[model samples]
Target: MLNKDTLLRIGCFLREQTGKVAVYGLKLNAQAVYWHFPKSIACFLDRDINSGFFCGLPIRRIEDLPRNNIHAIVIAASLSAESHIYARICDFCDSHGIVIYSLYSGKLKAECLGKAFPAEENQESELRKAIASHDIVSFDIFDTLLMRKVLFPTDVFDIVEKRLREHGIDIPGFKNYRIQAERGDKRHKGLAGIYLTLAEMLGWTDSQAALVMREELAAERQVLVPRPGMGEILSYAHDIGKYVLLVSDMYLQPEFLQEVLAENQLTAYDELYVSDDRGTGKGEQLFELVRKEHPAETYLHIGDNAIMDGWSARVHGFDSWLVPSALQILKTTEAANILSFAENFNDRLLIGLFANRTFGNPFAVREKLVSVKSLPQFASFFLAPLAAQYVLWLLQRAKIHHFEGVLFAARDGWLFNRLYQAAAEIMKLPNVPPGMYFYGSRKLCISAALQEEKALEWLKGHLVGQTHHFLRECFGFLPGDGHIPPAWGEDTDLIWNEVVDKKESIFARSAVIKDGYERYVARLGLKREGRYAFADLCSQGTTQCALTHSVLPNLYGLFFARYMSGSSVTMGRVETFLPQADWHMLANNALEFIFSSPEPSAASVDENGNIIFEEEDRSDKELKLLDEAQEAIEKFCHEFFSLCESDGFISPAIGHFLLSMYQQPIFAGAGKVFDGMDINDNLMGVRVDCLLTNEK
Candidate 1:
């Protein structure tokens, strides 16, 4: 294990050397060093090398390879075997005049490189300069001006395949077959020609082939989004009175491409040149067509392909600006390490969605390696998937159980209810139980349940360490009310005898609270005898117990997680979607706060059926941030539900792993999302300030 200082010194030394450098080991330590200095390090050398590669670098044997122009060899080994590895490599280093450094040593032979994943060059300014100098500005459509929400263009086939199977068209190996269909005799075939090949392979009629082609196009419409700031670049070219042309080596027709452009508000181009319309592509002929039709004093072409857009365009007498694609930029950063864990189809889909959003802005690397611009982007990347998974589980569970309706508990349930309704509609699933936001909280529900025998026990456990204001809030009393003595306002243990004395008074006040809630529940219009279920965050079934015992009997509870210590009467009616082991490992406060509503917690209800909310402790900026985050989560859920089928659902393990990455300090700028945020629990008299600040 190399310490940070040691790694820093070694990286600086390796980067400063002009000649080639090689690591001695071929394991994780070597991979880590390669990531830190990918361009600086040449290759890896080992005694047992068999012509393998690590991190795209070739592996070589020291005895078989020539040592000309070799600079240094760093022993990327554990501390226990560092001395032995150093001794084995020192003789070769001395003969070759190569300096050998230990992974554990703090001193090294050279200077430090500044950032982990620095930009290869300043290209954005150069691109703007080229656009300004040229009369005609040409752009590549795919991965340049426009980007797909998925990682690869062909991932669209996976989505189409999932949709096909959902509609009872389960063809095995459909995605691979679709890929091969396009890769047939001609490489630049149009949509119709590719589907004709698919029809021949699958023994389908022309109509069936056309249906499948339309499915692919629909999938494209769902997954396509504008690359961040590229639209502005195109508009800038147009504003300067330059003729802008969009070119792409794609099978989609020019008309459909225009519609896609218009849909994303990218309508500043003079013309679109598609490969399918001309049977030629940007490799050679598309640029020739672009030049022949639209002559200009000086032409500039901007694209992502190095060979097709740069060299090929230069051959056609046009200057080119080659920008890196989203995938190209993401592969250089720690995102590669994060994405290595994606082993399944669903996992890759999620990674693709995240890649589309996080890397869409090409200049994100200028500020930080992995840039989360705001709280909303943080929510979309880390929080939305977990929230969607919970909703997906609920959708399946509702169908299996045949529940009459779902009652989402207030505050936390506000987001869940909206997500549930949206997902249900998008999936087009039949017989889905109606989900509604139920305005009830622990404070309000526990007040209604004080008459029950176990309510006293619950109160003792939750309110013992709380202040008197919290006690009043729990029992439906307002601050500054003359209901209790002033000395009781301090942080004091709840004396059972003293509570007994106030029991009559508390019950008398709580009666109006119970009546107000009863009227509110009646207004929901759900049948009293229906098999209704309650949806909530982490709980021990207190809300469920109160609702079932007081207002609505025979109510079932569906929780993200449950943490009861002993057996209870509501055990059979309750089911925890998240397992205990997974629940404790997560930051439950963050989850609750991220998915929570901006509205204050429900404190109590008056006799006239008006709900009294807790004092709003959150600042207006905090409220605005929550609203933005909720919108981002909703957008992600909408996209996920629209594209992904219920089959091969996102696993809980993957969801947990993505969330842990956000909560940890692995990504730069993640802590900025929660920098000054606080979570207040008025009923418990607890406030978590600057939560999840990445203090380690």
Candidate 2:
């Protein structure tokens, strides 16, 4: 409310002024003056050459104003943002001897009426003083008290569009209509304003418009969340016994705004001031209503926008402050500083956008740390979000494609599977193709690969890369220490018989692996024809292929990523999901190394499902290192699963940085989390050749 102090300032300003002044900015503030104090604003000024007139006045550029008639230009706009022209207007005003006064030039509490300028950032404590002076503290609401989770303000519409799609409402190119609707809504002051436009353009009925509006509300309900500093400020206002009102220059009416407020647990305000409700917005005559509603009371306005929240509030004779977002700060400061070190344009964009969207606790950037580190802090920064996205994608695909529950493949799939289960439970997505684990691994599947004489021939041709440790560990052959294995011949059955006969092996690790596989099927209870998906870290499609040649022919493989073999079919399942070539971000080196188990994949599983290990004869140091890495991975995974919720998502931009973490040790430079962390190269390579690479 423009009370005694504010009115006294107006009286003092009038006494100082000799000639007429034009309010430069036809936004709600100018309209407010036009409605409340018409004689004060001689004319309206338009910085942009836009022809859209406001308040029945012919808008003029600073150049168009007559030098003799208009002696001053009251800048009822923002200098903090690019929306208004400050320098050009100042130059013209100065050159013409037309005195210019910026409304944002302030430190108003007791409200000393001044034309002198002041700075922006160092006013938070002073902002509290301004609030102290006010009987009622009226906030701008959107960026002031409440904040949306998305990047931009209008990203709210994108969520609405998604809701429309979900409801089977196909409105092609809805963005154009939305933009137009916004114009119409502001013009007519609500959703009812856009009804005619909708009917004229898309032949939408009043009922259809209502449905779209409801969907928009639903979208708001979906995305809306409280800002970070919400509690402290609101608590301060309440404790001070100040009448807090959420005054917004918004299209949504008080009733609708109430619904949103209640949903977000923000029902503390004394009243809601919406522009559309009165057909007048902030910077317009809307403050006149505020003045009328709460006579003799003072106000302090707070918001993110400089024009409406800061300048307009000051012009209307109230204290105001700008609350710059972290996004704005990053775009202004950190982006350029990172340019020298950034890998490329997209890399910079990823970093910038990630910093823009990702909001949480700051990185526990360790200082004066120990000499050695176990692993990188890529878990919180990269891997967690990546896994979350993967899980989200999996859920999305399962629902869209109508598949049975996913079966997580054992070994590398361990972490991913666990992540999926945890996220699913947290998000209440139990019905999203209910999942389970499948004890599938390269070691376990290699037995199925020995089906025919031709398969053994294929194996023989690809044995060059196999180590003595690999053979002894994976195949239950070559128990004695040897660099090279005994050369094999055409008889596949005879070769296996010699290998199996070397040790006191269970018959399950038999001559040809036929009886052993039969036992595996019975023990694991793997039905011959379940239409379930096999989840794993990566594959050459061989595990599924092996299963295809044996039992469970109807099963499919779901790998985190996969390389193509001659046949893309796994069991009878097609190659449905594969990362794009550009997604070869790590070049398959680091990620392959990281998503490993402490122990090599079990070369064999028995009738009772007990895992058979190959590293029994291995040294302790290698085992210890593997254990450390695995523990680190599990700890990272648990923390990730804990932090993720339904409200947040893993964007492709976040994924880009995540891939960068693997592509190169990008975050390693931070040195706090990963200064001396080492990759266990020993475990990076599986003992046996899973792919049996085509050694040319």
Candidate 3:
């Protein structure tokens, strides 16, 4: 898989270069270079950096590299994604006067290699023509009428192995044995024979094999969903009064397949033909049995397989229509290489979930559209996993650190808190820190910490524009007449100096803000001496710094990510879920959008312990999208945590992969949900565009 010969050539080329060398991608192809020629490479570069090091070499972002530090950059991505990655970074490398090289031969592989099925439109068109001309229309069951969520049919064995391990049936290499048994035994004996062979191979008792068999069936039932596009064609055939049949060259029991079909509501078929039942596979004699049963009828056979459903059916004198399987169709898109990189259970689960959600129709990614039709569905498949993993990591860390409580800081924290609560309950985590929504923000925290010198410095740093915008937005107070400068450029320094000039007024306001927060915390049942953790989407620890200076000295900061290394006060007191490498993938504002609440931002607190809020700058439509997206995320978390037996650890590499795929402009329909949305820094009076905006 590494193409060792190509790697050796690249290694020799790298050794011949004079200056520093860096590999441009963090996949296996790139790691191969570091492993073989450790002395030749200086560093690694990747847009989606999940770790600080790969094979003992430091990883650096292209933009972070100093001038003349590296003489050449070598690309190590797969050929499918290699071109796009090359184009993306080539200009930057050229501008920096760095040469570009590739570990690959720079040749593009044929797009649809091997015995891939026909294109979706062509297959559908041919099926319609055949249905009109033929009296009987037979369809292949799996991958044609119904689709499974996993990447491959064999992946079910992996799931079964995991489930068995969960139930204390730790059979090492169970998946390998399961595959060997299915392929080693007679094909016509069905599921029982496969299990029988597995028992003999593994020395499993008959009852033990039966229990595993039940689990395999359950996994199949759980992963299967109807292929909607093909289902439409099946319905049309039945509506036109043509005789229909469901055919499959599968070792599964016909009764089980029938039950699954009924569960999927595929009732248009007149008969079913199974290879196991007839003691012959489709490419051999199963089609002949079907022909004998329904003699002298013009037949059209539609399936995802080119051989079993096409050539074999034509040999039996029936017309054939070939539609590519979801995996085959996936090969035509950029995700083909990424999906191929999944080698472990968790990695495969993430890939399977993505493929199941996007490639079920096989034609879904053909147009490369980034417009999302269903916000809820997009949230479930795209946004939810990453968000859930962040909170799950927070919960696990909280338990490990033995924190007394967690304060989910207001606004975006509202969603994070909800997800945390839902996941903790589902996981049944014991002694999980009590999490509550704390009405705190940068403005409120800065106001509470005005007396602190560091807090004053942070406030001054934010004064790049009009002072009135700062005063009204940050403190909910208007500036006086002299504070409004005659010219636009003159006010920032003038107003900031004026604010420092009024120390007595600042003291009074700081007292009021601190008192308001103290009362609010009391009402939430959090004590001043309690070790409460503040959860935020991301920050440079300004909130935590301010809190430690003015109040809540026992508080800790738990962030999803930090844009940069934090201030000195938060050195040991703060934690982040994302590694330093992933800090660049999602902006802090984008994180706020996904982890958002419908309520307006908390501007400051009233004297009576109520939360004073900024104006609802978001339109009603934006609010609805936020509500739907968050709800979808919550639902996804509940379902995912309920079924998955994770230790609250999702590999950052897999997280990086999902995030990287989602960020691509061509990835299916992801841009639609975040389109036209704005991420508002209510305290700073700055509005940044959503990450996925401007794609259209």
Winner by lDDT: 1
lDDT of 2 by residue, 1-696 (tens): 233443444445545678777777777655655666566667778757545567876677666776538877665554453224444565566667776655443212213321112334324455566667777777777755665544455555655555576579878667567877676533354766765566667888888888887776665565455555553566577678888877788766689788877877777778888887876666555655776788754666666666677665665565665665535443343233443444432233334333433321111112211122333333334444455556656766666656666767655666666667766775555567777666556546656556445554444333333423334545546433333443322233434545444433422343345446656665655566656666666565656666666556666665666655444432345443435332233324334444554555555655554656554433466446445554554544443333233333334445534445332222333323332223322221333321112210
* Cα lDDT of model 1 by residue, 438-511, tens digit: 88887788677676436565666544455355456566443333455242245344345556666676776666
Model 1 Cα shift for residue 659 (angstroms): 3.5
Where does model 3 exceed 4 Å of error? Answer: 1-120, 123-126, 365-381, 426-431, 461-481, 485-497, 565-572, 581-591, 634-639, 642-645, 662-675, 692-696
- Ranked by lDDT from best down, the candidates are 1, 3, 2
Model 2 residue 466 CA deviation (Å) reads: 5.0
After superposition, the stretches of candidate 2 with alpha carbons farther than 4 Å from their true spots are: 1-136, 152-169, 185-187, 192-206, 240-243, 287-299, 326-357, 360-381, 388-406, 414-435, 447-466, 479-533, 538-558, 562-603, 608-654, 657-696
- The candidate with the higher TM-score, 2 or 3, is 3
Give the Å shift of residue 417 in candidate 2. 4.9
Question: Model 3, range 350-386, lDDT digits (tens) per residue?
Answer: 5666665666674455455434576566666666767
